[model samples]
Target: MASLVLTDGSQLTSDSQHLGMYSSPTASLVLTDSSQLTSDSQHLGMYSSPVASLVLTDGSQLTSDSQHLGIYSSPVASLVLTDISQLTYDSQHLADWCPLGKDTYFRKFEIYSMAWQNEINLDNVVLAAASYGGPVAVVRDRKRFIKVQTTGKPVISIYTASGRQMSSIVWTGGQIIHLGWSSTEDLLCVQNDGCVLAYDMFGTYLHTFGMGQEAKDTNIIEAKIFASVNGTGVVVLTSSYRFFLVNNVKEPKVRQLAEVAGLTVPPSSWCVISEDRHTRVLMARGSDLYLLKHSEQHAFPVGLDLRENTKSVVEMAVSHNNRHVALFTDLGHLWIGSADMRKKYCEFDTKCPSRPRQLVWCGTEAVVGHWDTVLLVVNRQGEFINYSYDSPVHLLPEMDGVRVLSAFTHEMIQKVPLVVQQIFRINSTEPGSYLLEASKQFQKRSHRSDEYIRLVKDQLNVAVRQCIDAAGYEFDPSNQMMLIRAAQFGKSFVPDIDSEPYVKMCRTLRVLNAGNNHTENLTCGAWCGLVKFGNFWYN
Candidate 1:
């Protein structure tokens, strides 16, 4: 053995007999016997005799063999293993967490613009359209429609399922700016100038509410878009800062709500009624978000305080469950708040392009139309599931798959490292306690996927063995005899007798074949025995 003291007072001592070595002030020490040394950083007995030890300047040491470096540092400074996972063999159990797996949660949508200026042959164009229920509506009587209207002019039109124009209403008006349908398909509201024209489902004009009169002789300063709930009345906000709620059925109800003074609402500003028509929310030019309770006509101050910053609120929608409200700004940031406008949950950046024209929550996912180049689908947790939809596509299936994956991704971001430390840092003394904790996590992860379950089961089995070994317990014939009973109550990932892992685990338990009285793969009798073993272990 040789001992050396470095100029800096760090020392190394190795049980390496007569080993010739050299050292520098900054670099590591070099040694012979194919083992290199320099600093006295290596403690006595540092070398394993079969190989040489590497001593570093700061008293750290490394044991080198032909294949691996058993690194050990004296006064260890937080040893960081770089990509230890890659260094280990590809564990069948760990393969379930694929690093390059697809994202879960988001789905994309295709955008097709129906012609705003096109002339359809009268032979193809129909008239008098109506939607009965759901998103589908119908157009009828093509020839009679042509005679009643001017040829080749865009007037009133209903969009078809294929995104084509199903019908057009012939009119002298310049254009129809906005359209909305009622829940019962009984009425369609169209906005033009200062008037909101209500039509019966069959194209009969029911009523026209004049906004200028409602605002009391004020000039029609701007046209705020209107949203009408199917069974509820139409919600209208005028540029004159006047708002009105008008229901035009057999029982007509009109209520004049609060008005904003001295504020000019741009044409792009819009008001949307809640799905139940009991509430309405509006966004104006200054980024001011306002909520109104229609039932009581009481304004609830949301205090979003987002006005005058010049950022537009691009999209706003109530959640399907009607329990949440989601609003997206022009900056690709999503904000979620309570449906009742009470609390805001989270706001975070997204990969969606700024200034997306539309945001649609399609069931499990949200789709954003980012100009013509990209479509982004995002889940509530903000994972991009699918994109680049340029053709006829069904996005729901892909969204479902991504949502499942997001659950796993979330767990990885939150749990995996702690689990590894918990398992590997255990003492050789109390294996049973560690075994119990590992089992719980394993079962929880098992539901993530089939591959995940397999991986977890493998780790759990390993931990079980180590725990038994640490406690100095062994599975002998007597215990083996009762293994079948234990397994009956035992926690097992094995459900099939044909699976290799199941067979191996059963063999470990030494479960005997009750019918033949011979050791074999799990039959029904073996399973019963295994359950009992599980009960024994668990208890």
Candidate 2:
């Protein structure tokens, strides 16, 4: 029997490491083990209490009292041993505080709101909300010093869906001519000096670029930002009345566009449309509209002419799909047509003779025209719906709807996607709705689940897909879980169903909810509550 002893609390041993011992009030060394120990005393004795020790054995004889195993009790002492979860939540019925319901079952969530009531003056605020539930970027009191320079600078603030301010950057730079968000969530601050600065989600300064030497040296008059396949693109009209394009923000690579012939000043209204891998600028000069592109600069033929009563275009907006457009004229004549102006959908008279404050597309189906406190949405059929906002307002067009931003509250005005309405609408015998009912019955352990499944067995995949998609539009974890559970339950009924879509949506909602669960950690971002209303009012 050999043993080693040390007084300086150091020792050396062979590979087997069998002849070392250490003792202390917190711990005491035992017999042979591969791990080496150093202490003032080296002697053979059993380990003491209070100091937890790691054990490695195949259910063999254990010598320590540290046998409790749980997430809280386990000490992270080994690389191989880690944490785990062992619970499964009941996700069938949605919990209280589910998303607000519009009409029968359309879900409308309170994505964001002002920190305080009437805190923001929407007239002075330049607001932009990125599509697909992206963050909103705001530049307060933006319409300041347009004619002349001022010492005041409006702060640039970015907020998430929960009204939590992700970042607030002091605007000490030049004149912020435009504040917009890129497709990748980078906030682009366009200055009058034609410098475009990019910032990340956390408000970190990315590099800066110029629209063009013509734009920078001669100065930019007006700018329009659009989303492109590669990155966010910007088109600027230089002081020389010439157009320039930065097709991709990442590389910047500026390209000057064809000039509109015989044009002396800026047009009344214009928009950038991206389609078929090509981008074009649609500008209206009085009643004559033109499409300016690298290939051609020609007069855009208005298929439905208002030649007798045509007035100057006041405001115009293109749909997100880049296929349709909404043109609001000074005479309150609103026209919905193709981007090329070749095919006209319908023409609706707003009956408000004055120019509209804002013109935007509502998910490619309707044209939203706002004048003062009254807002009107005229669909392609020329039928319209009116809305009222008592305060200053800004319109944010989305892939699904147009978001209305005022000083006190934020609301979305969108026609519910047809799939959502068909799936969850009351008394609907749609295949997707039946599948959801079947899943609910399955959760209750009723054999009716099988019967319901058999009814839609031919379209089970479509039904599962609809549930998965509806889950994305829901913010409430309980409601999201209910939709996802219905999807899962429906998936089990179809053996050949691809589980990838459902699994991906569940994972996405999990991550989204985890980040959105910051309600408890907020200092000023509060839950402004929700209103279950805004049923579809379409033609």
- Per-residue lDDT tens digits of candidate 2, residues 1-539? 22232222234434214422221223322222223445422332333122223322212222221111221111111111111122222231221111222332112234455553434456666777665445667776545544424555667777764455678787778888787878667889888888999887678898899876667788877888898767689988877887778888888888776667788877888889888778888887887777778665544434447636776887889887889988887777888888777788887777787887788887767778888998787777777667666778777777666777666666666665555556644334567777776776677687867877887889888888888877776555665666688888788777877788776666655555554553522211111111112111110
Clashes per model (N, Cα, C within 3 A): 41, 0
- Candidate whose TM-score is highest: 2
Question: How far out, in Å, is residue 273 in model 1?
Answer: 4.1
RMSD of each candidate? 18.7, 22.6
lDDT of 1 by residue, 92-147 (tens): 12222212113221111111222322433322432222221111122323324335
| Candidate 1 global TM-score | 0.42
Per-model TM-score on C-alpha atoms: 0.42, 0.69
Give the local distance difference test score of model 2: 0.63
lDDT per model vs. reference: 0.37, 0.63
